[model samples]
Target: MSEATPPADAGNTVSVAVSALDLGALLCSRVCHDVISPVGAIVNGIEVLEDEGAADMREVALDLIAKSARQASARLQFTRLAFGAAGSAGARLDLGDAEQVVRQVLEDDRTKIEWSLPRELLPKNRVKLLLNLVLLAGTTIPRGGVIRVAGVGEGDGMGFVLTSTGTNARIPAGIEALAGGAVPQGGLDAHSVQPFYAGMLARDCGLPLRFALDGDTATLTAA
Candidate 1:
């Protein structure tokens, strides 16, 4: 947790013990949290459409419905790859697919994403780790910001960096600790469980996760 120290304890090697069912439940909760807003918008639009006296606003309601549907779909697709088995077993994930999903979710008025990774395919596990980092980084910018994702080096020595910058940007406290490999003394919940899961993935893959923060900017790296 220190600025000079790596995000994870270099010499320490312990992982939180989470049951399969518990992990599944937590992940599902995350997915629901992401999709609910857009889904609610869609329902509200339908209700507006059903109001005969709201004829003057029908076009606006339709536009709202369309936008919300797209947002909901984008979230579901990203979640599938990030939390579910998106591709075949033991195969490299398609970078195009990953980029599409990310851009759909992150490239909006509030945030912009720049993908600097190689165009070549990447191992599925690595892609998952990268996407989860994006998800974590996106939450840092409350007002508006830029998230730059880059893949560097090669093979087991490969490194991934995610940098976020904006007004009032900051990583959430409990999530940052969990993502950096410190298990909370209390049990994980829907909000704090994601970083713990992501950290475990990095550790099991023999990657070291680190974080550097300065003022309103933060960088997360795994190498």
Candidate 2:
């Protein structure tokens, strides 16, 4: 499904027209969107109990709220690498570390994940690319199934292959095209959200996000 309507022009930018800073902002906001939900909810919850005085049930409510807020923030951070502009090269990046980070965040959810990879860190760009790739793969299934993830690292950089196999594997339209290059230019066209995010993130990181769609599964990868 198409992601929520992006917030104004900051969210939509043609490949050529988009700048690094713009892409950075887009990534930052996408990160914010996921994080703010639980954090904001927690804050509001706190104000409610604090102002009203902790009722008998306040302890349980506060505990659940706190746990959920932490989970949401962790997930959002993992998603930043996976779906948003993660980081640049020359910085410390561990694919295995990232994988664990993501899996830890996702484990709290109902989705059952099957993972395969060596304990190693990849370059910044490849890590970011794979994270986004996994996010896309996860979106394809609701009931959930096995996600086979394979990674290889070399002198130039690292590469990853993520396959989410399950019934009703419908990949998002926008992300499918983003792997090649450039989404068509327009004023917030219908199929212009995921691709934009993918494209912009790739551009910002100076990497490519490519989709390899074969039958029921899609693979996203880059260096």
Candidate 3:
């Protein structure tokens, strides 16, 4: 796997020719894609209830609708912290909020998150980087796993770590290359762009991302 740490453009520059609005739109598209299935299920359930005459079928449809709505809401909550502009200008985010959002995202997945940030607040940029790293690590454990996120040290000496372990754990192919500043021949789209985005966020936050993967375990450290 290729490993490189390139600096993101200073002053929040866009790496590509595309405008910032376009990039935001792309991220929004990704979020929409994720919630569409659950939202669609809810819509279908409502339609079924409206059309069906059988009370038992209507009850089942109601259950399906309730579950789907919860899933959609959770995804939206996660997206707000992970992708949306969450904090005010020059403000730190509450770690509790971050944990809550992370937990919500994990609710639907087989994976579990073990968060241990000793600090009560963190710079918004750091929180964004952390969430994105969690998102990246979440994709590695295909067969369910544990994601342990913790803060190490205190004050200026602080750093964050995310350790993912499970059966068949593996980083997605070409992600390391993307972090190393190599674009795939086919280019990146919504489905395969997150790892690259996380790398960029790390750079933007002036943090270095280091990863060590062996067998069914992967550890991501940022400082």
Candidate 4:
């Protein structure tokens, strides 16, 4: 991944060259890609439960169902805020709530989050941008690691920095361009839409976004 420079004027909207319909479709595809696995497990677990011959594995089936259900719920909740119209226009969202949802969605043995943002209210889009950045940072440490997030300021002047640390951690290919509002050579798809959307959110909030990689740490800054 390359470094992304902040826009000359933060107030200006970054041009994302994609149709609204295509953006929406790609985002939906991304969400489905995320939740499909656990959802499929849920279906499989139900099938097992409904099978009389599988009575001996009832405990296993139930455990699978419960775990899958929680995973599905967590993913949905995170996406609902990070990618959906979380509230009516001009609504405000609490950072505390954002932290909860992010913690839930990222709950797993391989990864950990250390969020240090205060429990303050911010415009819904800003909070969404923060969550999206967290999601993007999580991908850098695929081998499992820690994502440490901190607030840069407060209120309208707020920004964020997320640093992912793990063995062989790296910035995802093409993320710099995508998050800088440039269409990647491969074009926009479910896999690439997320960073693009994050870029859009950063611009919409008048916060320029940048990415850097140092050794085993990948840092994403939006300020």
Candidate 5:
């Protein structure tokens, strides 16, 4: 028998690839999270209509149906951002989409923001990264507080930082380590659970992530 050699690309293992897939799966889970409530309401409303059978309450049933459809539509618009399949490739995201993305995650009544970011000065890839980071921050504040978004306009690249402060927030330990680039060794569980996308984006953009954390302060700097 003749000896055979391994392929050249065989040496390229699947660490980050597996992580990326896991991230995608996590994003899909979020999409379901955003959609299921509205979808269930729609189903329930239809059941109510069947029971009503052309009574005056039918109008109420129709209203519920309309509200459910609107919910689905809002979820669709939000998902285009939270899980849209446009990674890098020179895709530029304006401030409009970026705001929508972050606000979508933080829109619930739990928290409010005191933003001070450039309304329109980020690329799509960067926005995607920031969205992930902001989502991490938002998860920290169950009772809500102030989110300060500040940026410095460099000649070519802009540096942006996000800081969140609240009364009853204990920044999740997973995000704390991830922001410092000392995230857990696990792959997607680290990245997907934390803000690994921001770290990846900073690398892709040839920038560094500067993290400073204290008792109740967390700041993420992208240069």
Candidate 6:
């Protein structure tokens, strides 16, 4: 049998086609990456407790286990809502709950969240989009900073603005292109799936998303 010739554009087509399975795998990887450290720390703490010679460090081990457990729980809760299928289709989510989860995952000694969203219900996807944006804003200042979240309007007209401020803060690399639905030059992976997913959520919510950099601050707006 003779071999058939391949289409000239086949390579280009395959390059940009990210299958649903690929996206799901990448997103799962991202969530795992976020929670793995704390999970591992908890295991380490358990190991230390099992070591009879380390009795002198029992207090430290207990503290580590407690802190790591909280961290793991917070990340899982945040991911459950932000990236998982939270609630039923078309269900509404309370912004108050969103604030609580965001605060749990993002606030620390070096990072702070200033949430100004009113206690109102919003579409589940919209709340998910806001949570993802808050995650993106938190990353803008890896050295630790403040994230200020504010909401505007009501119901279908709702919108949000989040600002990250800290020394050396700037927009995250490749976010603009990713948010615009372009696959990264380095190909889609855990690091790039988030912004792309955020953009998809914005489109589904019928909201226009934007990112801006001003001096030492980075802002994400969906309005």
- The prediction achieving the highest lDDT against the true structure is 4
lDDT of 1 at 148: 94
lDDT of 4 by residue, 50-121 (tens): 999999999999999999999999999999999999889999999999999998988579999898999989
C-alpha lDDT values of all predictions: 0.80, 0.60, 0.74, 0.87, 0.61, 0.85
Give the C-alpha lDDT of model 3: 0.74
Tell me which of candidates 4 and 6 scores higher on TM-score: 4
Which scores better on lDDT, 2 or 5? 5
Write candidate 5's Cα lDDT for 54-110 as tens digits. 677777878988988877877676566545755566666666666765664566566
Task: State the lDDT of candidate 3 residue by residue for 100-176, as single tens digits.
Answer: 88887774467888888864777777777788888878877878899999886655345688889999877666555
RMSD of 3: 5.0
Regarding TM-score, does 3 or 5 come out ahead? Answer: 3
Candidate 6: where are CA atoms >4 Å away?
Answer: 1-17
Which runs of model 1 end up more than 4 angstroms from their true locations?
1-16, 155-157, 180-186
1-223: candidate 1 lDDT, tens digit per residue:
3352343433343446778898899999989998999999999999999999999999999999999999999999998888888768877777678889999998898899888876667778787888888888887788879999888687545668888999887766555567766655566677777888788778766778777677888788888
Candidate 6 residue-wise lDDT, 36-137, digit = tens: 999999999999999999999999999999999999999999999999988899888889999999989889899999988888888899999999999889
Q: Which has the higher lDDT value, candidate number 1 or candidate number 2?
A: 1
Cand. 2 TM to true fold? 0.72
Show model 5 residue runs off by greater than 4 Å: 1-20, 53-71, 86-88, 177-194, 210-216
Q: Which stretches of candidate 4 lie over 4 Å from their true place?
A: 1-16
Per-residue error for 66 in candidate 1, Å, reads 0.2
Cα displacement (Å) at residue 197, model 6: 0.6
lDDT of 2: 0.60
Cα lDDT for residue 184, candidate 1: 58
lDDT of 2 by residue, 161-185 (tens): 6666666665654444443344445
Order of models, best TM-score first: 4, 6, 1, 3, 2, 5
Per-model TM against the reference = 0.87, 0.72, 0.85, 0.91, 0.70, 0.89
Worst 10 residues of 1 by lDDT: 4-13
Model 6 collision count: 0
